[model samples]
Target: MTDTDNVSRRRFLQATGGAASAVALAGCTGGDDSDTETTTTDSGGDSKERNLKITWRPLDTLDPVASTDSASGWVIQQVNDTLANYKNGAVEIESRLATDWSIEDNTKYTFTLAKDAKFHNGKKVTAQDVVYSFERLAASDSSRRASFILNDLGVKHETKTVTKDGEEVEEYKPNSLAVNAEDEHTVSIELSEPFHASLPMLAYTSFSVIPEGIIGDVGDYEGEMSQKKFAKQPVGAGPFKFDQWQQDTKAVVKRFDDYHGKVPEVAGVHWQLISDDTARYTYQMNKNADMFNIPTSKFDPNKVSVEKTDDMGRKHGTYGPVRNGDTVNFGRVGGISNHYVGFNCEKVDKKVRQAFAYALNQETVSNNIFKGRSKPAQHFTPPAIFPGGASGYDEHAKKYPYDSSKAQLQKAKELMKEAGYGKDKKLDITLTTYDANVYIEISKLLRDKLASAYMNISVEPVKFPTLVNRGRNGKLEVYTLGWLMDYPAPDNFLKLLYPPKTDTSKKGMASYVNWSGTEAAKKATEAWDKIQANTKPTEEAQKARNEAYLTMEEANWEDAVMIPLDHPYEDRMSYDWIDVPMFGGAGRSRQMLNTAKFTGKRN
Candidate 1:
């Protein structure tokens, strides 16, 4: 039977719990009649209230160039307009301001503008604005948002041009970081060589052109944009306009009447910053909100407006009905995101790292804690993102196995003995986790496994801010973090971990990953340099990336750096009124929102 015909709304909710990455069950029953009803309410002019309650934290900033963090990006995504965007498993090339473009040469791209596109302030978006935004990002060394753009295209430092080549072949002024605008409507982006992913690179929200007048006045834009006043109160050219922002509470957005494309279906969108999962689920259960995920404790398929369930959970959990509601299953997981538990390489012993790996059982952890809500992640990329991806690298094969037994226990004990920790000795370590039951379970499993090897593990639940600072400062023993791909390219994940640079150029965000400065990391960094210098996106570059990834992975393991673990399954629930594109991450896929016409009715 067709998906709509057999799948019950309750069954779907019970199985996936509105998780975008949850596994889909087959032959379930329950239709999304609620969503239909909600959409009908909106389209039929029942009420103009378009409020969406989400379980995400508040945004950090509003500036497109400054808001590189997920929270900030979430807000700016609605308020700012990029030159291009990714959605629906494809990058839909639309005329934000620049309608079309032509590759003038390997190093140059010229874009033609659409006269109609205008900023929310009523000023026309011009080439000058584009050049200004880029230049501003380049000038600020702290601006991580500009790395993708600046790295793809060559940047000039004071009185010298930093070529992609090993040789610094130029003498220039300090204005080197600036993008030169050739004309009002047309501009040329010149690089030392052709970067294959430049087009998609431009599609990032960071590349969204801003008003030239704003940045030209801001003095010494050298620090994090999130700290900038402009980022706190920014202007943009998007379908929505920034209204007001109350930190730790909410960010209000009003529909832009002068939006160039199709006007928004609802009058306004209320992005409520609700951090408590229980609270969000409670609201969803009570119908206070038309649709949302049901909390783990409160999830019930029978009480919901719809029902859908299938066998995706049985394969992992080995129990429960074939389906459930508003739950992220432990087994069925896809989409290109990778989540790994990493260890500290600087302070931990190599043998201890391997022992930890051997002690951890991904399958057991997946089934028990995740409840079939995630997949066993092996690498940075998933099979869905590339060819042979699911089966691509054999790196994990080189290390520990999930088979825990008496023999395995002896081996782990032996390793600990060699590492100077045995029955009489113990290693003290702090493991970091976000304040979540899911992570708590993972932490406990890790602690138990490590304890088997005579390691004294302590769980430290740090606030999100403290966690970010500690991770960036390289001040943790072991921390669990998830890496979601910014784009559909390997470079997005690979390069961000170790970007290329010149001997004179200052260090950048890649330092966050290579905090140890080991010889292997240095080599991987060199490989990144070579990849950047390469002219084409050929097999040679791919091979180089593969080599870099292997070297980095090995170094991380050998040095007892971050221990990589299995990726958990993710899921998303939709209110009957909302039609989120079933392609990738909710906001990551730009196309998901492209065809979403909000109906006035409540589903």
Candidate 2:
């Protein structure tokens, strides 16, 4: 679910009832057969300079932390700048607000801010603001709820001093405050534990630094999620400044001339909430929309006349040949996401789950159903982190490779028999899914495959939020959904599913499927403790972390706690003549469009 920014495309689509808004789904934008005339700022006849028309499916919220969908993260990208930047599909790290940074023993990271960065409010950005931004993410202050960064840091600050090898060193505290400003320009972030994930984790959207003055107000966070004024009217130190946001309608932003980094060439950006996919695609096909999630039909070359090519020269069908239909442009990057089917572990028997996992045919779905638009997932983490290689550390012993052979089904049937569902007894299960063309089809696939195992699966299609809510309430036997990665890391994928611990006090599985009570869950929890205890913030630490995560994943495959579906390939397309630098990968930070330039229209 690269919508993951894509999943967001569908979240608000059903609600919009109009043109395609931002891909409110995890990142997959849907198209309606409805057609609507559209227009871009570009005038014809060689006068190519114009405003960028960025269309999306819909946006339910403007609040960054409260933004449950990736489309909102897309909005945050245009307005806010995080600590650093990701380029070439998150393979390289470039300087953004921070000019230089260093890490000590993987527990501490010091970032030096670029002097020229200024907020649209004309406030000078300082280390104090950065520290405040990070702290706010984990703060329990009632103004709002932050989803991404809190997964990394706890709600409260804890710290302690200890002696180590004849020297005093700070140890992980229960409620340790992790980030602080050493001086005006130097921001020091100290984790309680040797959390090697601080770098990539900081790259998430919710980690975007805002002016301290904005959030420093006494009542800044004391309001309902949507009513938080600061969240709606965001101020940031990025190339684009928020102009206007009409919820579910459109969002507008203009260039921030005082931006410290590379500036955007387009005078402003206009994101229209087009709910219908076909209309959205037709408009982009006619060059009305400058950038959008290219519809699945657009990927079909015969359906549209796309003649441009990315520098790599891959056809636009799946890899992206930027300009097609009326000669548009595109930015191509493999999606940094993992789509999965979450099982309610507390209710599901391990053998039942294992049998279900073995029966899934993700390869056929990714290739045949998604038509090469997605990669068959081998593990929970996205293979995109390594850029076109295997997505896991290594194939583990419990790997349930995609095998549709009768022998595999026979084994599954044998497992079912142990559960007493084989023979005349049919295991009846209700599967919940979001109402999207692809999701509906996926549910059907699951139903079809499980039939051979004598499992009666019923598919119930509902809205994305409702499906998520049901997962929280433990209402469904199996739920079809995708969790987008905030950043590229195994922790981002593992921690949410099998948390080190589960707090029943927090409602709805704490945004995870509540896999803590099972044996597979216990093993995964144990693996996390090992990763935190032994791993450092280095290549060796990554190796250790990978090994640990692979074990945990293998265990899950064996237990069938959760079933991984696929990692949908993500793409950002525009007219080739647009000359805009582009990014759409794992980290939401990559969607920042500051450095992009609009070079006239197509040739």
Candidate 3:
């Protein structure tokens, strides 16, 4: 999920940030003293020693519980293994740490852990570890996604409202979450209600099993280390182990020999922090980085050639014979996310919001800014999971049009005039966004366009963390951000626009856009309520849910709570010698490098 800056797996993917080391080359040695050199035989029967160097943005946190952005998720996933994972390029769940699972009565889920799975410290994974992990995640004050497990999935937990520094806060009761260890290798979870997306939700990295009693205060077990130390150097049962993390520079992870899954083809992975798009492109072009995302400024659609598109819409191809005269492998897929400009509805008038939405051309912005790599989003939910699916998306999009044209401009001018802003009275506001080149460019374009509609917009680009903090505190009036899917479900996207989730009084995450006190909010909430009550498997129930989604979409559009921008395409370029796996659009944050191999000699 991206808020403008960090692309957290389900939290945020900063349009710019990632977690990587500052290594100059893939083969260079730079990590903790525990790092060792190893050689692996390639498919061609040739043995070579190499470290996978990848380009990434700055990471926010590595603590899985507290991680809400993709930059941190990218690294946390490497060091932690979840019970299940999405099949490559699909929403289908596949086994990871848990070999098999069973769901009974829709509310009871039992997972059998793989007996062979071992933590980085060589501790065998047990049912107790899984229980401890879930409990810790549920109770941690630092966890940004506690609600996902506690409420979304309906995990049975007890909470008490307490006053902290004169402010009310909800605290979880000890040993109340209905997660239990049935046996040494089996774990059982009881939910407060049946949820269809429970399995997929459990696949989230926040539920990753760590060594039992590794960190204290959240669980009954006495911990071996402080939570602070664990965040810096976490140990888990994933394919890779945390080796070193240099703040703002890079994070290195060495392959774990005791990993139960297929061992990594490379000795380790060197995540190089190249936040600058141009610098990252240069790093890959210079052969310093093996795999990287092609910057929009550097992307040439003419140079891209698609070989095939999978069932899930993942395009596999080659990039180009660029300035280096080499054609690199390419992959592209539509992200299950949307980027938009949100308004603090409490502060910004509805007419003003509608005027701004009318004045901005989503298609033009997406085409010009993203080089035609993204599709203009008419609704918050991407077409892949929009209501009744693709057809439902088309119907709603046509019913509510927000694209800019001569007519739209006229409407915007009229609305601005009605809102008491005209030639003499101008609506001046600052548009806050992450300090990324792409957002800066987008903000500038918006500023220029809105100026004609009697609105003077100032662009304020702050760090990704600051932008998120200000947004949560309702300190931002107008801001640009994006939401990547937490799961492959419509509710994940729709919930963002749900007024209650953005109520500052409720300490909402997206509270910058305070739309809770409006008629539109009530309508959207009603639709959301209908959706929750209609989760049965019957055809009628499904139809009602889809209709409710349409209602929510309509409510959001009519009120102009947020100006939906575009659905971005996830694209990547890798050196021809590397066999980089294509993850398609979903679960990019859970992308694992263990399967990546050096197929040939690197140039």
Candidate 4:
């Protein structure tokens, strides 16, 4: 798990101009980029018992609130439903549990739930369920407190003093509930202040609507309610109902026959957790697994053979490596999907952090390692990811280009010296990531690039969950991560670093990025506050937010808090049998889980 697992779900989206990786279908290697034609029509519409296949690194939890990783989000998507959702490659706020929704005076958002929607246990999806799902998030021990409760909805993070041993310490928690049920079918979310991007925030699985009857009022990340019964066996108004879960093995979700939304044609979905990349690809190659992303080795030089090449000079596995059959290539699913190197501000000082940022060249990584599959990003979040930011939006990426120039590198070396790191007094540190082939290659690159510049680094690969666990403790000195957007707004990117951990239990909170109390964080928060005050999603709001971020990001670059990597173009291949309804790269990672069906005849 990268920091996105940490959202450092980058706990994850990128908005930028990027190309999709070319897909070589079996030995055929046909079709231009982004033209696999998977989304032309809906597959599995014939109403049959076809099992939808998916691959993952295993789910952390089905408890939507506590589950921070994308794998967990995928599972939650099938088992639960949000008030609103982003479907069909757009963020249009389609009605789900809520039949209709409206905004009043830019402060109150009202959603009317459908009368027919029911949970797996036959409970009707009501306004009380909606209110309970939200209040539950603000409970005593919820990891999602900052993400949805405090940050997005705009509320106070209030704390009360309590006695610990003899001394009294502050027991901080989110000041919650502008969320209430106006009536049984109607749910209203009233923010203390105007939050322009509130609806988009509801589209995230983290803000998923769960049954109040099961979890109850005070949500628990541990113990009986959230984890024991609900996390493993969930009940929601989604297209699928939870069938069974065997951690690290598989999770089975069966189609709900009486779903309010379009019922999936498939009888069920098989979420198989394939840990090994080679084994995962092997399943795809033999068509044993219906879908999986193209292996990092196909694009990364580390695992890819040099001899494999297509006529267009692109690599095809059949040229040397084994080729998978008739794969569908859907290029560059939109939004921000950037990979970055984040410094543990507690251990790495400002000067050393800046030096580390300027030490390497993104072009080398973009051209060679990524093989033009991903754009080498220069900012933490891609500007185009935000609403009203497609054209004429100012970005901080240009300020710090991929300059491995002697002047810049020299400045970096000087900073390294200033930080008391040189040949005699070296800054020794270890960078950790999950044991994925792609991440291993990335860590290796960072280690070599930083070592060449004077920051002596050792790459340490751990399990995905462990990487996220270690991130919370600030054990990693310099770690590699990419943030995936929870929603298609600048707030999603900005909020990833917002809600600075100010309390004693801050280390325990996953949102604690180790950059709290820094001048950089203060400035970023100030700019974000200005952005939040804009009242509505408009061109003026986007520009104001963009300009404010420009100042924030410039300071961030100088502070060297996070080194921007490219928002690489993501490319993926599915079998011709696969029908990918939403293909916005990482954004649609979980959205298409319910609607996606396998219609093509299997041999």
Each prediction's whole-model lDDT (CA): 0.54, 0.61, 0.76, 0.62
Candidate 1 stretches greater than 4 Å from native:
1-49, 88-95, 152-174, 215-227, 290-333, 393-410, 496-507, 511-523, 543-551, 554-557, 568-570, 583-595
What CA RMSD would candidate 3 show?
8.0
| Clash totals in order | 77, 70, 25, 34
Candidate 1: residue 356 Cα off by (Å)? 2.4
Candidate 4 Cα lDDT to native: 0.62
Q: Which lDDT tens digits does candidate 1 get at residues 1-603?
A: 344323332342243243222212210001122221122233453333453334445565676665545666756766777666553433333346566665534455666665677887888888877776776666544355656655654542345567655765543343464356677787767666666566556767777777775644334444332335667777888777777776765665666778776656554444555556666555554444432333443433333222333322212211122132333222122445555566555556668767776676666655556655556544544433332244444434434243422125567778898989976889998888865566777888878877878999999876555665676666766777666555545566656445232111334454233334667557656756665666364567666655655555554444444444555444445445554434333233243232344444543
- Candidate 4 lDDT, tens digit per residue, 454-481? 7777889887678777777657777777
What TM-score does structure 4 among the candidates reach? 0.81
State the RMSD for candidate 2: 10.0
Please, what are the lDDT tens digits per residue for candidate 3 over residues 118-229?
A: 9999899999999888877887767778778876787888889889778888867767999999999999898886665777688788898999899985856678888888
Q: What RMSD does each model have against the real structure?
A: 9.7, 10.0, 8.0, 9.1
Residue 254 error for model 3, in Å?
0.8
How good is model 3 by TM-score?
0.90
Task: Name the 10 consecutive residues with the lowest summed lDDT in model 1.
Answer: 23-32
Poorest lDDT segment (10 consecutive residues) of candidate 2? 17-26
**Candidate 4 regions with alpha-carbon error over 4 angstroms:** 1-47, 155-176, 216-226, 299-330, 386-396, 401-411, 502-512, 516-522, 535-543
* Top-down TM-score ranking: 3, 4, 2, 1
